[model samples]
Each structure stands twice: as structure tokens, then as C-alpha cells.
Target chain A: MIDQTALASAAALLGESWTPWLVVPPGLLLGLIFGAIPGLSVPIAMAVFLPVTVHLDFLSAVLFLTSIFTGGGFGAAIPAVLMNVPGSSSAVATTFDGHPMARQGRHSEALGLALAASCAGSALGYVILLLVVGWVADAVLLLGPLEMFAIAAWGLTLIAVLHEGSFIKALLAGLLGVMIGMIGMSARGDMRGTFDSLALVDGIPVVPALIGLFAASEMFRLMRRDYIVEDKELRRPAFSRILAGVGMALRHPLVVARGGLIGIGVGAIPGVGAAVANLLSYAETKRRAKDPSVFGKGEPRGVIASESANSSSEGGSIATLLALGIPGGSATAVMLGAFAMHNVTGGPRFISENLDLVYAIILGNFVQVVVLAVLGLGFLFFAASLVRVPLRYLIPGVLLLALLGCFSITGDMMGPITMVVFAGLGYWLREHGFPVAAVVIGLLLGPAAESELLRSMQVSGGDPAFLLQRPVATAVLLLLVASLFYPLLRRRRRA
Target chain B: MQGQRGSEVALLLLIAGFAIWLAQDAARRSFSFENLVLMVPVAGLILLLCGILAVAALRRAPQEAGGGLARVLGLLALLGGLVAGLETIGFDAAAFLFLLAATALLGERRPLVLLAYAGIMTFVIIMTLGFMLPYEMPTLLLDPPR
Candidate 1:
């Protein structure tokens, strides 16, 4: 499977250009900045800088874009760790334990672990991509609407896994989220819960709603405290702790490897990218762990699982883009535009004709992972200072930033309005022992599940027996059922 | 304990009401297969979940302690006001006022500190974000010409 001649040519092509090297740092920095902010997403960052790529050669442009992709992958975890505000949907699982670690004054260490896991996951994804890019395209083709719906259902199982308090309440919250997610115009142009507002025509903007539920709600809770880190002595940033955190992550190589594998597999699916990948990885890790109870309470392994999966998903997504010309998510969609600008279509024909370039792109991402680690450390060093700021100041500052960021997202009042509304809902949910994360999972997967199920019903004419013909979907559903019941079986056995 | 249970019941009722409304709306919009496919089942599930939770809430003893309700509400109200003020007063003015009031609400006592912090941050955040973002943000004081 290794094309030695093409690999050598790719190496030569990369070596021929110094511009690509120069663009990597800036691209990574831009991605870090964008991904660190609550509402600014990787796709927005890529779209903003896409026009500038016109000046560079194709290799340099691709390198620059991928560097941003790589950086944003880890960049999102920063706020998730520090403020409990996941910068993107992909980082939602990162906040499960990362913010708890921060509150414990382990912010530096959490950031360190995130950086390490991200670098490793990205590298692992590219290595897998290098091995499977030739056939991954064909493999992805087998996933139809039924299969996609099953994958989404699999993601929704996270609501069950995230339940630590009242399972009933968690399920209620998750169902609420699903209902909210299904609000607005349906596929057949029928409106449900839009309240007759024109803005609801598109649907509730997910990112802004995310900001409200996680970040803004958390801000309200933090107002009771004086600073992010309760212990004043532990608020100082420690470079040593960050390094130790990296060492801690290194000790959990198996967890990182498992997360990377899951990331690649899940991320390869369209409409279900890093967001689902990270959650699935976290849920799986939590489920498999000896002490699953410690998961949401500053578990280092939680950070490792989430960050690794989200970062590696970049490689998985890039694989689909390169092999099938299909963008996995919005970020990859922007990359597809860059491809179009360069007069390069990304299909099997393109990959077969330009295998060397594909190899070069993968190889370049490997280098980016190394650079990301170095840059991420420096970025974390500064970001870690967030703990020292008094909550009185930090709360308003960050809340305002989130409001502004949401405004930027929707280009109207809808973003901020949705955020504020969800903030209230989120706070109530949290206060009532309802898992906000469950609600988030529901919101993220509900629309996709609904659309895919609708498509499947249309294709199968609503026949229940149609599932028999689709073995992949059947297997996935079986796995979902097994995962749901496994804990009950284990508990009974232990009892 | 009674109050807490009442609140929980109220929340459950609210959710149940929402589900009922959604189901009615979907059906009213012409019970087309596409419209009812996801909504009907989701709304039904929500009602079922709400029933279970409400029943459980009534049976369970209240054991959780509550505090910071006032602060959370104050902050939430301020946040709501900030969003409301954005289009009316513009981002810059609205943000500065929000920062000032929120800082005070959070217990910042020094008047000079509040004013300076709010003014500087408002300017810095708006100018920086305005410079970085591609779209135009409406601002009373710092609305730059396109």
C-alpha cells in the first residue's frame, strides 16, 4: 500500500518550498485564536483566511489550511479546560472534566494533557489516513441515510452515559434538547416551534445556543465564587505542572490510541464529525474505566480521551475530503473551496493522478502536529492565567465576549437572543440535577437523526423489514442496544 | 422542600405544555408524513419523560441545598438586558453599561475602578473584535464607516 516513489516525490515537493513552512505558524496561530474564542469556529477562521491562500502555491495553500485545521483542533480545548466554555461543539466533552481540573488549580496540567493528546491524536490520524486513503473513500460510500441515522443514535446514547445524577431528569433534559433541536422548519418545509418568527426559518443557531448553555450558564454559577481557582495559592501558572501533565498523558498511551482510532472511524462519517467523535470517545473511555465514577470530576483521562479524539478527527475528515471530494463538516467544506480555487477537484481520479500531493498533505500535517505542541504550550502558558483573574471581573468580561462572539456568529440579534434564552434554560437544568451535557448531545444529534430517519423512511417506504437488508445499520443498532444494556448487566453480575 | 418541589413541578408542567403545543402545531400544519415523522414521536417521548420526572419529583424527598439564586438571576437579567440593548443602544454603549452594572452586582465597590475597567474593556473588546471580524457590528460610539 505504500507508494515509495510517490512518497519520495511528495518529500521532494515539500522540500522545494519554504513558503509552506512559513505559513504554518501563522495559520496555527490564527486557528488557535479563533478556536479559543467561544463563538468563533474553525470553519469561520478558515473561511476568513481562504481568500489570502490565493496568493500562495497549491502546496503552500493546502499546508496553511491544514495547519489551521490542526491548530483549531487543539485550540478549542483551551476554553473548555479553563472556563467550561467549549469553543466549539467538538470541545464539549473536553469541558466534562477539564473545567473541574481547572477549578482544582490543575489548569496548567489539564492544558498540557490536552496539548499532548491532541498532538498524538493528530499524528495517529494522519498515519492511519496515509495507510487507508486509497480505500477509505469507497468504505465511506457504504454509509447511507439509515447508517448515518444509526450513527447519530449512537451519539445520542451519550445522554445515557453522561447520567450521574437523576437518570430520569437527564433523559428529560435530553428529550427537551431533542425537541428544541427539532424546532423550526422541517425537511418538508413544515414549521413546528418557530413561534412564527422569520429567523426560525433556518433553525436555532447551534453554536450560539452552545455558548449560552455551557459558557453563559457556567458564568452565572461562577458568580458565587471570587475567582476561577478557589485556592489563591494554586492560581499561579506553572510550566512544570504543564510538563508533568504531558508526562501524565504519555503514561496513558492506550487511552490516547483508543481515542484516536475511534476518532478516525467516527470522523470518517459525514455530518458526524469531531463533535460526536470526542463524545463517543469520552463515553467509551468512561464506560471502560475501572472507576467510572471519577469521570466528570477532573479525571485526567477524560481530557485525554476528548482532546485526542477531536484532534485526530481532523485527519479522518481530511481523508474523506481528499478521497471523495466530499466535505465532512463545515471546516472541511471551506477546505473544499480552497481546492476549487486551486483548480484541483478532490476525488479518486484526482487522488490516483496526484498520489504524491496527497502524501505530501498528510506528511505536512505530521509536521504540523509537532509545531502545534510547541505553539500550544506557549499558548497555554498565557491562557492559564485565566484562573488568577477574579470571577467578578472575569465573569462580565467573558460573558460580554461571548455575547459579542454570538453576535458575530448570527450577524443579527438572533445569536445573542438564543444564547441568553438557553443560558436561562441551561442554568435551570444544571440546578435541577439535570445534565446539561445530555441536553447538548440531544441538540447536536437530534436534527441529523431526524433528517436521516426521514430519508431512510422515504427510501424504504416505511417498511420495518427494510432494516433486514441493511446489515450495517442493523449491526450499529445492535451495538447501541448492547452499549446501553452493558452497564446494567455488569452491575447485576457484580451484585 | 415544598417550594423546591413546586418549582420542579412547574418546570415539568412547562415542558409538558411545550411538547403538547409542538405536537398540536405539527399536526395542524397538515399531518404530512414529513412534518409528523420526527415531531410526533419526539413530542410524545418528551411528554412521557415529563410524566416520569414529575411523578418522581413528587415521590422523592428534597435533599439538595440551594444558594446563589439571587446572583444567578441578577446576572441572567443583566445578560438579557445586554442583548436587548445591543441593537437599540449599539454594542459599545450596551457592553460598557453591562460591564459596569454587572461588576457592581458582583460586588465591585470602587466607583473609579468600575468606570475605568468597564470603559477600557468596552473600547478594547469592541475595537479589537471589530478589527478582526469581517461583518459589521453596530456600535453607538465606535461604529466605523464601511
Candidate 2:
């Protein structure tokens, strides 16, 4: 079964100097730097570096990028724990408890738990991705418009659980986001909120808006505060305490499974990336917690749920990229440019025809996890230095960057100004006990869900019953309904 | 504070008006099955829903503590200033001032450090946008030229 040509090509790809293990440190450190900076995006990193892949072969470049991606996921925890600033969207959950834990003088233990969970979840996600690629391809393709609609609805339900305040308020926030999304045109060729001005045509760029809202708002909040992060000497969690996480991973297989599945599912969808995966995983993990009291309170499982899903989705994301030649998210979209640069052909047929070369890429994830684990543990031992960085230098520079980034992105003032408004809106919503997570979920899902729904409707000639006609779509719709009422149902049972 | 809530409600009303106007415009276009107007009513209804809910939320919790009116008002003022200043202050001037003002309002320890970073960031963004990846704009606003 070992084909000669495939193995030879695989060897040629991995045959570079330093092989797989050599580029690990540089890849990881660079990722840490990106994550350390609050507003720098992963897609930006991948896109900028894609040209470099032209000189190297596909396997080498992929290995480097994968290492960077994994490292970026781990590195985001640095700021999340330090300044309560999330360096990446995936690290939002980490900041919830990780910062609190740092304040409590338990940085080492918290970080150790984060690292171990990140590695375990990452490995689990990768394993699932590698084994289930073909099966997932078949399964995802079977999902019709109705099922996709249900999935979006389910994604929206995360607002209620994650916000943990009022379901009605969460629904309000999600609906507001959807309404905002309606500002742009639709798949059916209708202009919305255009106001006769060409400038308002495209509605809003989610990435820029997101960057402005979350990243800039954070800076604004920091500027408004006169606060100090008191330095604390923390206990170094022993190898046993950290390794004890493996059993937790094994014991709460559902958490690991849910995170991995969400990661893969989110990864398979174009444009939606690890950010959604992390949010979905966090919501699912919180919703499923038996005690239901541990999230946002330094629970080890919370870290595992988020980090695992973030890292796990990387492998699945790559499969989608390779098979469909469609970029799964921001980062991989950039990787596609790299693939084109290096003249590497990608698709489902690309793998079977060259199985060894494909396996080399898959096996490279194993290397990424190993590197992530070593670096993560090493950093955890001395996490105090990371926590010691002063916000004074970072705060102002970051604020400047936020505005500058916004203006520069649109090359106009409208974009930067939008950042201020969105940030204010975000702050306002937060004050009102509305979950920021719900709004983000709604904003991310709105256009995609609406367009897909519209397309499906048009395809079925405007038949509303078309949703229930398909079995997969029906099941997903039912699941969406369940996600909404499950808590109320449980409350009734208790009563 | 009472004034603050009133202004927000007014904005909601304005937005609802805009939504109604947009829906009317959409309805005038092709009403065929292919050019569906279904989402228009749906979207308008959602806006009205937002208007109702936002007014309700504002009413329900009149003075939920923390974050003063100055900060809130200053944020609104910043948005207005940025919109007014763009295209005339020529991005660098506007951006530098925007960061300077927003950062100052936010509570940074030293303005000098932030201003320096703002200057550098302004220069880079301008150089990149103007030189590296330039874009064309047809008068960001329709007002008479200076």
C-alpha cells in the first residue's frame, strides 16, 4: 500500500534543512509577538507572509504557517492573563478567568492549566480533523439551506447562555446585530440602507469594525481607568497538576468532543474562523458544565474548551482549504495566496493522488502540538515576567494604533469614527447587562445566514416548507429549537 | 442623565424612520419572486423591534451605576468630531488629533508618549494608504468645497 512516488514526493517536501522541529521556536516566538500586540490580525500575518512561500515547497511553508497558527493561539493567553487584554478573539474566554486568576496570585497554576488544556485540546482537534476529513466532507455537503439556517440559529442561541443575564436582553442584542447587517445589500439584489450614497453600499467590513470595536474599545476603557495590576508571587503548578488535565480531558470527553466538532464545523464554513470556534466552544462548555458555576471563575475546563477548539479547528480548517481550494477563514485565505504563489495544487483529488505529501502536512500538526506544549510549559514556569509588563507603555500606543488602523484601513476618517461608535455601542451594551458575545455572534452570522437562506428560498421558488422537506435541515432546525428551550425545560423539571 | 436617555430614544426613532424609508424604496423595485421584498418588511420589523426594545431597556434601568455621563457624552462627541474632521484634516491631521483626544479622554498617564506613537502610526498609515495601496474617494461628503 506504500506507493513509491507519493513517499518520494513527501520526502522531497519535508527534506529541507532543520526539517520539522527546527522552525518551531521562531514560529512560536513570532506568534507570541503578534498575539502580544492587541490589534494585529492572524489573516494579516498569513497574507503578508504568503509571498515568502514562493521560494520554498508546499510542505515547508505549511509547516511554518501551522506552527505560527498554533503558537498564535497559545500566545494570545499572554495578554489575556496579563492586562486583561485579549490579544486575539480566541483568547476572550481566557481573559475572563485567566486575568482574575493572575490578580489572585495564581498566574503559574492558571497558565499551566491553560497550556496543558490548549495542547490536549489542540491534539484532540487535530486527531479528529485528520481521521474525519472525508467523512466530514460528505456530511457537510449534505447540509442544505434549512440546516445551515438552524446552525445559525443555534449559534445565535449562544448569546443567552454566554451572557447569563436575561434571555430577552440577549435576544435583543442579537436582533440588533442582525438588523445592522441588513444595512447592506442582499443576495436577491436589493439595496438596503444605501441612502443614495455609494459609500454606504457595502454596509460594513466585520473585520475592521470588529478590530475597532473590541481592540480600540479596550484601549478606551483602559484610558478611562486608573488601575494597577498588583504583582503577585505565584505557586508553580507541578507537572502532576498540569498533567492532571489529561484525565479531565478524558473524563469530560464531551467537552473535548464538542470543542473539536465545533472547531471543525466552524472551520469548514468559509469566512468564519477560529473566533467562532472559540466562542461556540466556550458557550457549549459553559452550557454543559454539570455544576454550571465554574465559567468566568478560573475553571480549568473553561480554558480547555476554548483553547482546544481554537487549536483543534486549525487542522480541520486546512482540510477545507486543501480540498475545496476555498479559504475557510481569514488566516487560510491568506494561505491560499501562498499556495498559488508556490504553484501547489489543492483539492480533494490533490490528496488521494499524492497521499504522502498530504500526510506530511497532516503529520506536521503533531509537530506543532509538541512544540506548542514545550514552549507553553516553559513559558508557564516563568509566566511572572509576562505578567510584569506595564500597561502604561502599551495603553497609549495601542490607542494610537486603534485609530490609526481604522483610518488607514478605509484610508478615510469614516472607518476610524465608526470604531468609536461601535466601541461605545459595545460599552453601552455591556453596561445594560447584554452579552457582548451575542452581538458578535449575530454580526458574524447575519450576512452568511441571510444570503444562504435567501438563496435556498429562491432555489425552492419561495416555498417556506422547503426547510422542512429535507431531513438534515429538519434535524438541525429541531436542534436549534432545543438549544433555545433546554434550560427552561430543565428549570421546569426541577420545579 | 435624563437628557442622555432622551437623545438615544431620538436616535432610535431616526433609525426607525430610515428603516421605514429604505423599506419603501425596496418595495418600489421589482416585486417578483426573484426580486423578493420579504426581507425588507422583516428587516423593518426588526428595526421597529429594536426601537421598542431599546426604549424599554433605557426605561427599565434608568440609572444603573458606573461610567459617568461625561465619558458617554465625550464618546459621542468624539464620533461627531471624527466625522466632521475627516477628508479636510487629511487623515493624518484628523487621526493624530483623534487618537490624542480619545486617548486623553480615556485616561492615559502621559499624552507625550501616546502622541508620539500617534504621529508615527499616522505617518505609516498615510504612507501605506497614499503610497502603497491608494484608493479613490468621490467627496466623502456632499458639502460645497472649501
Candidate 3:
């Protein structure tokens, strides 16, 4: 795999890259814009731009799409930090500490940390890919339905139990979210809880629900404040502050490395990518932290853990896409379409024949990481100005953008309606001390857990002993049990 | 303590009721391995958990700080009306009106600033999203029906 011939071919490809350099800037910008926006995700941008890629050569097209992928990964975290609105679902965990850091007048540091970690993670992910793509994909395939259920269960439990509120209430909120996720028609085509609404047939759209729960609800809570940050002196966007943040992120090398490794492991598994990786990494980082209480209250490590994991997951997803010819999620699925457009297939055969192309793509991602850091810094200089906008303007403007974004998503009233409804519900839930993060995660992961459990039961003829078959599932189950009980035990010991 | 706890209990009861309703709906289907398979089991579990949580919540005092209840309610009402008015008044008109109402509701008292902000926001939205993006939102003023 590390042959001189392959290395020379990669170098040649890099040297002969005609307009690939030209496409990189626009590709990253397109990704950043789409990712920063509320509803327009990386997949949507890639899907829309995929057709244009047909006119370009294969290498340039893949390079352009992946640049968007890399840019969007970090771009999603901006709104998550500043507004508690995850521009994409992958950034949901980023909001846990990122928003608190913003509220504490540390928004620049948070954004900088996220950017630095993202660049580092992307570079590391591709390095791992350049070494052992085959091993990563094989490991990912071992994660069956049982293992998925355990992972989802672990995430929900951790999110609920780790909150500063009443544990039971958090659990209730999480359970309610899962129930809401099961609202549409089930896998068997039987309607579960549509309540006679035709829109319920297709299930509640996650993006609108997320915008409602996080952004609109936060906007409502923010109506009392004049500005997001109360101290007038700390509101301006400063390049020095961002550099300080970058320095702080560079100081914590271990956290970034751990997050990146977790991302690669979880992201390679199909149907579970950055969405789960960020949350899992954050939870794990907090669990191992010296002072876990600082996690949701502006801890820089939280942002580092989340951003690195989500960013690194891109490499793992691409590994699965190339080596196994399996797309890990929607973004990679769009890349698969790009593959089709170029009349190329990705599998073992492609790997055997075109080892140089694989190396070129990975090498391009490494360059993307460097380009993203420079470009992302410039973008943040402008984005940080958002904190300076008064609440009165910010509230309505963000809400309007969210409403229109939702409309763009559903192409009907359903999107806006779901958003407004969830906004009110989310506000009430937040007032009652329910962990909205738990609810959102539950909503996001519920469908996967449900389907996995159903599939497990189907495979085992509805026997509870079916869980005993998978060793990985058993180990995860044990870990889940420990996670649930360990916190209560510690509380009791403190008392 | 009692007042906050009462509200918490009520919320939990509502959730429990919803869970029960969901379970009942799931039960309406046959117990085939394929149809409504996980729905009944999951709904039942949710109902049980909601009941347990409701009992637990009833015994606790809420410690959350929520001072802006009225503001939250007001904004929600405004957004509700904005959604309802979108198709009739169109995206541009409805958005401009909603911004004006929202800014005022959120304590922006100056008329000129409000007008300027609303106009600029509406223009930017129409130009960027309405014209630039491929989204085909229903609009009366900007994108009239053929």
C-alpha cells in the first residue's frame, strides 16, 4: 500500500491537477454556506452540485464534492455554538458546550477551537485511510443491528443521565422524543401515531424539528435579552480572540486525537456516521474529564471532542464509500451518485486497479484540511459579528430564515407547522428543566434503534436470548448498564 | 414547591396519556411478526416509564429559572400567525410583516429602524432564497401564479 510507485502517482496527480485547485475554493465556500445555513445540508449542496460535476473530470469532481464535505463539517458547528441551532444534525453535540461558551463571551474561542479541531481531525482521518482502508471497512461491517441498538441506547442513556437536571425528567424527555420519532408509519407499513394528519405518513422531518427545538425555542428564550452576550464590551468579533482560541485548541492534543479515533471507528459503519460519532465522543470525553460539571458550562474540551469527531468521521465515511462501495450516510450517498456520474465504481476491484486514484483522493483531503483552516478563519471573522446583532433583530431574522428554510425543505406548510409546534413544545420543555438535547438526540436516533431492534427480533424469531449471540452487542450492553448505574452510585457515595 | 410540582405532574400526565393512546393505537393491529411489530411494545414501555416519571416528578420541587414565560408565549403566537398567513399574503409580505411584529414585540420601539430592518431583511430573503435558490415557495407578490 505504501509503494514508491503509488507515492509517485499521487505526487504526479497533485502536480498535474489542472483546475482542481480552482474548484477547491468554491467547493469549500459552497459547503460552508450550505452547512452554516439552518436546513441546507452538505448532502443537499453535493446533490445539487453533483450534476455540474459531470462536465468536469472525475478527480476534480470528487475533489470539489469532498471539499464541500470537509467545509460543511466545520461550518455546521458555527450555528451550534452561536445560536444553539445545529446547522446540521452532526453538530447537535457541539451545541452542548459551544452555546454556553458563546453566552460566556467566549464565542470566538469556541469557533476557533472547533475550526482547529476540524482541520486536524480531517487530516488525521485521511492519514488513517491512507494506511488501512480495508481494515476500517471490515471493522465497520461487524457492527450489526444489535450493535446499533446498543449504541443508540447508550447515547440516549448517557445524554439523559448526564444532564444537570432531574435524571427522571431527562429520561422522560428522552423517551418522549423517541416516541415522537415513532410517530409515522412503521417499517411494516402500519400507521402508528399519525393522528389522521397526512403529513405524519412520511414521519416528522428532523431538520424542521431541530430548528424548532433548538433555534426557535432559543429565540423565544432570548427575547428578554438585548444581545446574546450581555457585556457590551465583549460583543465584537476580534481576530486576536480567534487566534487565542486556536492556541487553546492546539494545547489539547490528546482530546482531538481521541475524538478523531472515535469518529473514524463509528463513522465507517453504514447508517451511523457523524450524527452518532459527535455525541458519543462528547459523552466519552465528559465521562473521563476531571470535572464533568464544567462540560455543559463552556468547557473547551466539549467543543474539541465534538468537532474533531464529526470532522474525522468524513474520512471513515469515505473509506466505507470507496472500499466497500457502501455510503455511510446521505452525503456519501450523493458522492456515490458522483461515482456513477464519472462512470466509476468503488470496491475491492477499484482499489486493486486504481490504488493511485485512492491515494490522490486522500492526499487531496489532506490539502483540504489546510485550505479549510485559512478559509474558515476568514469566514468566522464575519460570522462572529452575529453576536453583535441585537436580540430584537436576531430573533425575527433567524426565525424568518428558519421558517423559509423549513419551507424550502418540505415545499409545503408541514415544515413551518412542525417547526412552530415544536418551538412552543420545546420552550415549555426547557422551562420544566427537561434536557432538550436528550429529546433531540432521541428523536434523531429513535428510528434507527427501532428498526434495529425489529430486525434483531426478526432474525431471532422474537427470542430475548437473541442478544446473547453477538459478542460486540453483549459488550456494548454491559457498557450501557455501567453507564446508567455508575452515575447513581457516585451520587450516593458523595451523599 | 407545590405549584411547580403540580405543573410538572400535569405535564407528565399529559405525556403518559399520549403514550397510552399510542399503545392503544398500536394494539389495534394484529400481533403479526411484521405489522405494527415494535410499536405496541415500545408504546407500552413509554407509558410505563411516563407513569413512573410522573410519580417521581410529583414528589420534587422544580428548580429551573424561567422568567420570560410571557415573552415566549407572545413570540410563539406571532410565529403561529406568520405561518398561517404565509400562503395568503405570500412569503415576502408575510415575512416583512412578521419581522415588524416580532421586533416590536421583542422591544424594538424605533419606527425608522424597524422599517429599515424589515425592508432590508425581506429584500435579502426574496433575492437570496426566493430568486437565487431553486426552492419554489408559494408567493403572491413576487412569484405570482400563472
Tell me the DockQ of each model, to 2 decimals. Answer: 0.76, 0.25, 0.59
In model 3, which runs have C-alpha deviations exceeding 4 angstroms? A1-4, A196-198, A462-469, A478-495, B1-6, B32-67, B132-135, B143-146
List the candidate numbers ranked by TM-score, top first. Answer: 1, 3, 2
True contacts kept of each: 0.85, 0.30, 0.70
Clashing pairs in 1: none
Number of residue pairs clashing in candidate 3, backbone atoms closer than 3 angstroms, sequence gap of 3 or more or interchain: 0
Question: For all the models shown, what interface RMSD does each have?
Answer: 1.3, 4.1, 2.0
Candidate 3 structure quality by residue, lDDT tens digits, A1-495: 575688689879978846777889899999998899887788878877888999989999999999999999999999999998999889988999999999999999899999998888778888888888646556766788889888877777665545776776677777788888888777767777787678889789887998899888888887878999999888889999998888888898899998999898778888889988899889888876757888888999999999999999999999999988999999999999999988999887787788888888988988988999999999999999999998889989889988878887787889899999889888877877888888888888887788887778777788888778888999989988886677667777778
Off by over 4 Å in 2: A1-17, A76-114, A134-137, A228-253, A293-299, A377-393, A407-414, A463-469, B1-68, B71-146
TM-scores for every predicted model: 0.96, 0.81, 0.93
The model with the greater DockQ, 1 or 3, is: 1
CA lDDT of B97 in candidate 2?
A: 71
TM-score of chain A of each: 0.98, 0.86, 0.95
CAPRI level of candidate 1: medium
Residue-level lDDT tens digits of model 1 in A1-495: 879999999999989867679999999999998899888888888988899999988989999999888888899999999999999999999999999999899999999999999999888988999999999888999899999999999999898888887888888788888888888888777887788889998888888888999999999888878988888789999999999999999999999999999999888887788989999999989887878899999999999999999999899899999999999999999999999999999999988999999999999999999999998899889999988888899899989988888888888889999999999988877877788888888889998999999999999999999999999999999988988888788877888
Query: How accurate locally is residue A210 in candidate 2, as Cα lDDT from 0 to 100?
Result: 64
